[model samples]
Target: MKVEGGCHCGLVRFEAEVADGPVEVLACGCSICAMTGFQHVIVPQSAFRIVEGRRETTTYRFGSGSARHIFCTQCGVKSFLTPRGRPDAMSLNLRCLDEGHGLDVTNVAVDQV
Candidate 1:
Protein backbone atom coordinates (compact mmCIF):
# COMPACT_ATOMS: atom_id res chain seq x y z
CA MET A 1 0.00 0.00 0.00
CA LYS A 2 1.21 3.48 -0.83
CA VAL A 3 0.77 6.09 1.88
CA GLU A 4 1.32 9.85 1.82
CA GLY A 5 2.14 12.14 4.73
CA GLY A 6 3.59 15.50 5.69
CA CYS A 7 4.33 17.88 8.51
CA HIS A 8 1.66 19.79 10.39
CA CYS A 9 2.32 22.98 8.47
CA GLY A 10 2.37 21.05 5.16
CA LEU A 11 5.91 22.06 4.37
CA VAL A 12 7.44 18.61 4.17
CA ARG A 13 5.64 15.87 2.31
CA PHE A 14 6.53 12.23 1.73
CA GLU A 15 5.33 9.01 0.22
CA ALA A 16 6.07 5.44 1.25
CA GLU A 17 5.16 1.96 0.24
CA VAL A 18 4.10 -0.14 3.20
CA ALA A 19 2.73 -3.62 3.69
CA ASP A 20 -0.75 -4.13 2.31
CA GLY A 21 -2.07 -5.95 5.34
CA PRO A 22 -2.16 -5.17 9.01
CA VAL A 23 0.73 -3.03 10.19
CA GLU A 24 2.57 -3.00 13.48
CA VAL A 25 3.53 0.42 14.89
CA LEU A 26 6.12 1.12 17.52
CA ALA A 27 5.70 3.45 20.46
CA CYS A 28 9.12 4.20 21.84
CA GLY A 29 9.62 5.27 25.42
CA CYS A 30 12.80 7.15 24.62
CA SER A 31 12.89 10.72 25.85
CA ILE A 32 12.57 12.42 22.47
CA CYS A 33 9.97 10.11 21.01
CA ALA A 34 7.94 10.14 24.21
CA MET A 35 7.98 13.90 24.39
CA THR A 36 7.06 14.26 20.72
CA GLY A 37 4.42 11.53 20.84
CA PHE A 38 5.87 9.94 17.75
CA GLN A 39 4.47 6.59 16.65
CA HIS A 40 6.81 4.77 14.32
CA VAL A 41 6.17 2.84 11.12
CA ILE A 42 9.49 1.58 9.96
CA VAL A 43 10.10 1.13 6.24
CA PRO A 44 13.05 0.38 4.02
CA GLN A 45 14.87 3.33 2.46
CA SER A 46 13.95 2.11 -1.01
CA ALA A 47 10.28 2.25 -0.09
CA PHE A 48 10.21 5.84 1.02
CA ARG A 49 10.58 9.16 -0.76
CA ILE A 50 10.49 12.83 0.06
CA VAL A 51 7.92 14.23 -2.29
CA GLU A 52 8.32 17.86 -1.37
CA GLY A 53 9.91 20.45 0.89
CA ARG A 54 13.25 18.70 1.13
CA ARG A 55 14.99 22.05 1.31
CA GLU A 56 12.61 23.27 3.97
CA THR A 57 13.49 20.48 6.38
CA THR A 58 16.16 20.41 9.05
CA THR A 59 18.11 17.55 10.61
CA TYR A 60 18.87 17.01 14.26
CA ARG A 61 21.06 14.31 15.80
CA PHE A 62 21.91 13.40 19.35
CA GLY A 63 23.16 10.54 21.55
CA SER A 64 25.71 8.86 19.29
CA GLY A 65 24.52 11.06 16.41
CA SER A 66 23.55 8.03 14.35
CA ALA A 67 19.89 8.74 13.82
CA ARG A 68 19.02 11.72 11.63
CA HIS A 69 15.80 13.22 12.87
CA ILE A 70 14.34 15.17 9.97
CA PHE A 71 11.79 17.80 10.83
CA CYS A 72 9.93 20.58 9.08
CA THR A 73 11.60 23.88 9.77
CA GLN A 74 8.32 25.73 9.88
CA CYS A 75 6.30 23.43 12.11
CA GLY A 76 9.10 21.58 13.89
CA VAL A 77 7.32 18.31 13.25
CA LYS A 78 9.45 15.20 12.85
CA SER A 79 7.55 13.52 10.07
CA PHE A 80 10.21 10.88 9.40
CA LEU A 81 13.72 9.98 10.43
CA THR A 82 16.62 7.63 9.97
CA PRO A 83 16.73 5.55 13.10
CA ARG A 84 20.00 4.71 14.80
CA GLY A 85 19.08 1.03 15.09
CA ARG A 86 18.11 0.84 11.42
CA PRO A 87 20.33 3.24 9.61
CA ASP A 88 19.23 1.93 6.22
CA ALA A 89 15.56 2.30 6.95
CA MET A 90 13.16 5.17 7.55
CA SER A 91 11.07 5.58 10.67
CA LEU A 92 7.91 7.47 9.80
CA ASN A 93 5.61 9.09 12.30
CA LEU A 94 2.24 7.32 12.06
CA ARG A 95 0.46 10.34 13.42
CA CYS A 96 1.73 12.37 10.51
CA LEU A 97 0.13 10.17 7.88
CA ASP A 98 -2.79 11.58 5.97
CA GLU A 99 -6.20 10.16 6.72
CA GLY A 100 -7.80 7.47 4.45
CA HIS A 101 -4.45 5.82 3.88
CA GLY A 102 -6.21 2.59 4.83
CA LEU A 103 -3.49 1.41 7.18
CA ASP A 104 -4.70 -1.13 9.69
CA VAL A 105 -2.63 -0.63 12.79
CA THR A 106 -3.00 -4.05 14.36
CA ASN A 107 -0.47 -3.58 17.10
CA VAL A 108 1.52 -0.88 18.82
CA ALA A 109 4.49 -2.37 20.66
CA VAL A 110 6.10 -0.32 23.38
CA ASP A 111 9.89 -0.18 22.93
CA GLN A 112 11.80 1.17 25.89
CA VAL A 113 15.54 1.20 25.67
Candidate 2:
Protein backbone atom coordinates (compact mmCIF):
# COMPACT_ATOMS: atom_id res chain seq x y z
CA MET A 1 0.00 0.00 0.00
CA LYS A 2 1.07 3.61 -0.48
CA VAL A 3 2.00 5.16 2.84
CA GLU A 4 2.20 8.94 3.29
CA GLY A 5 3.72 10.60 6.32
CA GLY A 6 5.64 13.54 7.74
CA CYS A 7 6.87 15.19 10.92
CA HIS A 8 4.62 16.91 13.44
CA CYS A 9 4.99 20.22 11.67
CA GLY A 10 4.46 18.62 8.26
CA LEU A 11 7.80 20.05 7.33
CA VAL A 12 9.25 16.68 6.30
CA ARG A 13 6.69 14.96 4.16
CA PHE A 14 7.24 11.70 2.23
CA GLU A 15 5.42 9.10 0.22
CA ALA A 16 6.37 5.44 -0.12
CA GLU A 17 4.66 2.42 -1.55
CA VAL A 18 5.38 -0.62 0.55
CA ALA A 19 4.19 -4.20 0.59
CA ASP A 20 1.59 -5.29 3.11
CA GLY A 21 3.14 -7.94 5.28
CA PRO A 22 5.36 -8.60 8.23
CA VAL A 23 8.62 -7.56 6.64
CA GLU A 24 12.09 -8.31 7.93
CA VAL A 25 12.55 -5.42 10.37
CA LEU A 26 15.35 -5.04 12.89
CA ALA A 27 15.54 -3.17 16.17
CA CYS A 28 19.11 -1.92 16.06
CA GLY A 29 21.59 -2.55 18.84
CA CYS A 30 23.09 0.94 18.47
CA SER A 31 23.22 3.82 20.91
CA ILE A 32 20.78 6.06 19.00
CA CYS A 33 18.43 3.28 18.03
CA ALA A 34 18.48 1.96 21.59
CA MET A 35 17.23 5.27 22.95
CA THR A 36 14.83 6.22 20.11
CA GLY A 37 13.54 2.66 19.66
CA PHE A 38 12.83 2.62 15.91
CA GLN A 39 11.41 -0.25 13.90
CA HIS A 40 10.25 -0.85 10.30
CA VAL A 41 10.81 -2.75 7.09
CA ILE A 42 14.09 -1.39 5.79
CA VAL A 43 13.97 0.03 2.28
CA PRO A 44 16.72 0.79 -0.17
CA GLN A 45 17.35 4.25 -1.66
CA SER A 46 15.06 3.35 -4.55
CA ALA A 47 12.00 2.94 -2.34
CA PHE A 48 11.65 6.31 -0.61
CA ARG A 49 10.99 9.85 -1.80
CA ILE A 50 10.93 13.27 -0.21
CA VAL A 51 7.75 14.57 -1.73
CA GLU A 52 8.11 17.90 0.04
CA GLY A 53 9.81 19.79 2.86
CA ARG A 54 13.37 19.46 1.62
CA ARG A 55 14.20 22.93 2.87
CA GLU A 56 12.56 22.35 6.24
CA THR A 57 14.62 19.21 6.76
CA THR A 58 18.04 19.07 8.36
CA THR A 59 20.55 16.28 8.89
CA TYR A 60 22.59 15.22 11.89
CA ARG A 61 25.39 12.69 11.59
CA PHE A 62 27.34 11.12 14.39
CA GLY A 63 29.34 8.09 15.49
CA SER A 64 30.88 6.63 12.30
CA GLY A 65 29.25 9.53 10.42
CA SER A 66 27.45 7.07 8.20
CA ALA A 67 23.86 7.53 9.33
CA ARG A 68 22.04 10.65 8.15
CA HIS A 69 19.46 11.51 10.78
CA ILE A 70 16.87 13.49 8.82
CA PHE A 71 14.21 15.35 10.74
CA CYS A 72 12.01 18.39 10.65
CA THR A 73 13.63 21.57 11.89
CA GLN A 74 10.35 23.01 13.13
CA CYS A 75 9.07 20.19 15.30
CA GLY A 76 12.24 18.13 15.67
CA VAL A 77 10.28 15.00 14.81
CA LYS A 78 12.47 12.40 13.16
CA SER A 79 10.28 10.75 10.58
CA PHE A 80 12.97 8.73 8.85
CA LEU A 81 16.66 8.37 8.21
CA THR A 82 19.33 6.41 6.39
CA PRO A 83 20.67 3.52 8.41
CA ARG A 84 24.33 3.67 9.44
CA GLY A 85 24.66 -0.06 10.08
CA ARG A 86 23.16 -0.68 6.63
CA PRO A 87 24.20 2.32 4.58
CA ASP A 88 22.22 1.13 1.58
CA ALA A 89 18.94 1.08 3.51
CA MET A 90 16.57 3.71 4.93
CA SER A 91 14.98 3.23 8.34
CA LEU A 92 11.39 4.37 8.49
CA ASN A 93 10.28 5.55 11.94
CA LEU A 94 7.09 3.53 12.20
CA ARG A 95 5.81 5.92 14.82
CA CYS A 96 5.68 8.68 12.23
CA LEU A 97 3.54 7.02 9.62
CA ASP A 98 -0.12 8.06 9.23
CA GLU A 99 -1.48 4.54 9.23
CA GLY A 100 -5.19 5.36 9.16
CA HIS A 101 -5.79 1.73 8.26
CA GLY A 102 -5.27 0.68 11.84
CA LEU A 103 -1.74 -0.64 11.79
CA ASP A 104 -0.78 -3.21 14.37
CA VAL A 105 2.71 -2.99 15.86
CA THR A 106 2.33 -5.06 18.97
CA ASN A 107 4.21 -8.20 17.88
CA VAL A 108 7.23 -6.21 16.73
CA ALA A 109 10.04 -7.24 19.05
CA VAL A 110 12.56 -4.73 20.35
CA ASP A 111 15.92 -5.66 21.90
CA GLN A 112 18.33 -3.19 23.53
CA VAL A 113 21.86 -2.36 22.51
lDDT of 2 by residue, 1-113 (tens): 66778888877888776666645556766777767766655667777888989999889998778889887999988888987667776777777887683443443455421
So what's the TM-score on candidate 2?
0.81
lDDT of 2: 0.73
Against the hidden reference, what TM-scores do the models get? 0.95, 0.81
Please provide the root mean square deviation of candidate 1 (C-alpha atoms, Å): 1.3
Worst 10 residues of 2 by lDDT: 104-113
User: Who wins the TM-score comparison?
Assistant: 1
Cα lDDT, all candidates: 0.91, 0.73
> Candidate 1 overall Cα lDDT vs. reference?
0.91
- Residue range 24-104, candidate 1, lDDT tens digits: 888888789999888899999999999999999999999888889998999999999998888889998999999998998
**Deviation (Å) of 25 in candidate 2:** 3.7
TM-score of 1: 0.95
RMSD of each: 1.3, 2.6
